[model samples]
Target chain A: MPAPIEFYFDFSSPYGYLAAQEVEGVGRRQGREVVWKPFLLGAVFKTTGSAPLLDIPMKGDYAKRDMDRSARRIGVPFQLPTPFPFSAVAPARAFYWLADQNTMAAKDLAMALFHAAFGQGHDISAPDAVAKTAAMHGHDPAAVRAAHDDPAVKQRLKDEVQAAQDKGVFGSPFLLVDGEPFWGHDRLGDAEAWAKTGGW
Target chain B: MPAPIEFYFDFSSPYGYLAAQEVEGVGRRQGREVVWKPFLLGAVFKTTGSAPLLDIPMKGDYAKRDMDRSARRIGVPFQLPTPFPFSAVAPARAFYWLADQNTMAAKDLAMALFHAAFGQGHDISAPDAVAKTAAMHGHDPAAVRAAHDDPAVKQRLKDEVQAAQDKGVFGSPFLLVDGEPFWGHDRLGDAEAWAKTGGW
Candidate 1:
């Protein structure tokens, strides 16, 4: 079997949310498992010395419009969460904690959290909101909330962020197919092509 | 006739070169004229407080790889010119000077210059080189070289750059169809769709 497609994202990223909605279809079509790895974009931004897209001059306004247009084009419901670019600590921690038990369940929880954050404009940055979203996916709300403060879960997220940096993933919705990195939600097609053809 | 598609680009941007090769076709397919506007990205970068893609930390490395992969995928020969991200003042000035007389011929010169700078790895940043490339397309070498220093032509480029910034153009290969902005070469399809459907 081919290597799994490593899908790296941050919970606060709109593009990441959009890609999460579509990446699995690409994975299923190509006979590859999509490993959903959620990390902290705030942490990644700090290490890269980059600011959030909505904070940059000129480009920020354009990004807002582009994100809306992109989501619309893909037939996905999207709205920028209030107090956006919030610390994704709660959601990231919940993902790793759930991932330790059931990978698929963790992916489902990630999607639920993403939908709550971007689709419904809920602030998943809050532990309560993240736990509520996880609860909707059949996970224990109290346990998921507790996972946010678990020492091992927090370190797991930190290590994953470090691993992403070590692998040179500096952007959300970053995909790795056999260690070939493709960044941006726009490059999903190229990533799938690379996965299918094993590079041109 | 519908409003023409405005193709904004910088000479030194690799994606701009790739987009230049493809944007005209998009315009043709959509039955719209593509007005190629060569502006100084350096000026745009100043206002946007952005750095060259090849000068950024991790993004720089990924950009190099993505550029090659994107070029290969599109079947275009591409090589990063020596001293890339060089001053495109000469080329931008020459384009405006020629554009005043013949827009089509100016576009031809722009494409030739793009080919020289990216396809052949020649430094079209130099006035002499720009003149030589223009001369091959039936322009007078001396006239083309003189236009680079022409005060009116220089001012024209400056005005164009300012206009682009005013329109919120903060990146290379930005396409505007009926005033809707689409940045990046990957968005050529989006731009074309918008032009065809008058937006969704």
Candidate 2:
């Protein structure tokens, strides 16, 4: 057994969705409790001087292809949602609210939202969609929504994103095991291995 | 048919080797030529402030895994070279010199070197090994050796690396099709598509 693994994410990122789906089983197998830390990706990127694919067309187009290839390789179904680069504020706040209830539940709903946004091509910003996805994971959608609007919860999400920046994390789906940051979904294996061997 | 593609490369990168192995076939199918440009990775990194792995340890380790997984998914034979990062200066310079004799020859030898370095785990810097590999591609071993040591040829390679940086290439295995730069081996398909549409 090892210390818990915390995953930082934004509901808008497809890679974060993949991590949410894939890293759960990996964490359980390696005796680590996978904690979801949903945060604002836009804030982190702004401060870190990073931009989405829309800013760099060459890298962005390639990323979409790589994500398609990666999902297929990993055996996950994928469908890119329209209205890409969707606003993540509402969904991100909902995630923080749910995480305060049960960390694992927050993770499951996050994946469902990802599947909706990037996999099913649904808009997660729509309150109905976010509520429906949360309900699927056994949470009272209205209660989750209420908590989402709480000033403290909203600030908590903002603080987590800020904390991520302090920890040298500049991207979504960052996994920190015993405080060592792993910045991509692809690195989940390393996160697991480190948990298993207690390696850095 | 589309115009020829300008393929930029750094021999130290495993992906460049992978692309070199397959780009010609892609070019031939589309009735386009590949203009191979061998450049120094060190120079590109120096100008762009791009460090390997973006300062995330877990992400860096997982990247190696993802690369291996990508290689396997592509059905390319690969063996991790010992002394993980080998000296690439000699082979990169040789590639530049060989371009003077035959661009196609340079491309072929570069693939062979990649297969040798990453596929077979051979030391690409060794004179005997380089000569042996060059001979397999029908290049005169003695001439290859002589070209490697030519002072003028070495200077030309530095110039090419600088030129690549000036062109906003901050990464290895950059592909320019229809004047659009596709960075990274992961973007090969996009480059191929552009070649098909006479884009680059």
Candidate 3:
């Protein structure tokens, strides 16, 4: 009805995983639509000159602990994915491909993929893994797999990431409320307040 | 009493300014002593291979917006100071100097400096500014000025920053609650909960 809250996240970001589990509720509470827009942090990082939070020196170790503790604090399941900071091309492309046909199903598949990667600490970096996760949401595995390699699906994902970078979406769990960009899972509350109060 | 909650911050950090306003209240609410430790972010950044949050590319523009928005969302005054990311040596050294004489006075003065920097959007890089802030907190201006360059006071601040790095603190508004390191003002709520529940 009003402006939809555009949630931008990367598949490999633990903070994005944590926010994915909660942003919908926040949107529902504020009477706004939550649009899940997954983009490649790898591409965004190239523009920002930053790396994965876990790739830094001492901060890398602290991030591991924070991810676990933050998940627990928020009452969500989280296990750090292995070979993390994975590329979002597979899952993101699959999401857009499915979203073209079914937006609801696309969201469901996104939950499944996030859950697989962060909930159980499994690797969803492969197209097969993303397709498998999609199947659980009633999508055909074969179609899902095909979307990953389809040129249009690939471009859709590319265009989305390009749009995000052009708009300065530099980190995971970023939200855009009426074109106001809120970065990091940390700002979820602030985003919620912005949605609720109309402005601050 | 158990261990006091350790607050590590750099004087020039916007998030640190926000946290400085609330950490004491959180500590009081949780029935713990809140220890204020000001360190040089420049030194910590050198060790962590990180630069100021605003120095990065796309993220830099977003950070400026986030700082102001977050400060309002949380109901605190904030404005980006001129020539932002100022050196913390003068303010931090003055803090440590006053701390050596009076811990309470040091905290009061710390608040004054933070208010001067963020609340009024003033430059606090000069020794005179810090001395003036301390004087407002009931300390003598001349004494505060002399402490900024005192060999012992300078070394004290340096040693504190070194110790913080050894303990893996790499950001401002970082709180170590019962040895659990929480980075960012965004994690302040998590830190408070950790202090209250003995950690989740």
Candidate 4:
């Protein structure tokens, strides 16, 4: 079988939330399976020496406008979550914990977390919030909450983030086809084309 | 007449070079004239606290690859100029000088400079090099060279950069359709759509 498309994202990223809604369809069209990997953008930012998009001067204002415009263009319900860019550790750890059991359920839990954070403007930074979202997806709430602090789960997230940095991922909504990297939500079309044609 | 699309770019930016090749076609399709405003990204970067793409760490390496890949994907011949991120002052000044006389000729000259700098990978930082390129378009080489050092020409570029910052332009290939702002080369299509449909 051909290699799967690695879909890397951060739970706090608005563009990542937007791309998640469509990446499955992109993979489906090309008969490829998408492996969802939620990593910490904050850690990547430290290596890149970059700040959050909304922290820049003029670019920040434009980004705020673009996020809303991009969401509307894609027909996704979006509102900048209050306490913008909350820590994504809770959701990310939960994703890896469940992913160890069932990849499909992990994806469902990821979408649930993304929807609650961006789609409904809920904060998924807290362990309880993340656990509640996972519980809705048939996960045990107590187990899910405990997973956030589990040593193995935390190590998994740290290793995944390091691997992402090693692979040169510097932004949210990054995708990889085979070993080729495509960054940003806008590049999803290009990524799909690359997968379909095996690079142009 | 409807407001024309404002196309802003920097000569040193690879993505700006790529977008310069296609922005005019987008404007033509929507029955709108494109106004090319070449400005100093270096000056704008100061306010935004951003650096050149290839100067950043891991992102720099990925950008080098993406520049080549994006160029090939769009069928445009591209090479990161020998001295990547060269000063754009000379060519920008020459542009404003010519634009003051004939907007059409100025547009042609802008493309010619872009082609020489990015398409052919020539160093365009010096006034003499800019003059040589301008001469190919029937401009007097000495007059074009002198224009680069003229105080009024220098002020025009400075004012343009200031105006761009005021309008929240923090990156190359930034487009304004009516009043809606779109950044990056990938957004050219979205800008065209907005112009055609008066926005979605």
DockQ of each: 0.76, 0.09, 0.84, 0.83
**Which is superior by DockQ, 3 or 4?**
3
Question: Which lDDT values do the candidates have, in the order given?
Answer: 0.90, 0.74, 0.87, 0.90
- Pairs that collide in candidate 3 are none
Q: Where is model 3 more than 4 Å wrong at Cα? A: none
| Tens-place lDDT digits, model 2, residues A1-200 | 56678888777788887887777797779877777777777766655455575445334555776577567656788777877788887788887787777766766777778877877888888766688788887878887777767899779877877777677566778888887666676667667776776662
* Residue B91, candidate 2: alpha-carbon lDDT: 85
Q: Which is the winner by TM-score between candidate 1 and candidate 3?
A: 1
Tens digits of per-residue lDDT for model 1 on B39-117? 8787677766787788888998999999999999999999999988788888889999999999999999999998998
Poorest lDDT segment (10 consecutive residues) of candidate 3 chain A? A43-52
Per-residue lDDT of candidate 4, residues A33-125 (tens digit)? 999999999888888899999999988899888989989999988888889979999999999999999999999999999999889999899
Off by over 4 Å in 2: A1-91, A96-200, B54-56, B126-128, B198-200
* Residue A188 error, candidate 4, Å: 0.5
On the 0 to 100 scale, the lDDT of residue A150 in model 2 is 86
User: What residue pairs clash in candidate 4, if any at all?
Assistant: none
lDDT of 3 by residue, B45-93 (tens): 7767787888899878888888888788778888988978788789999
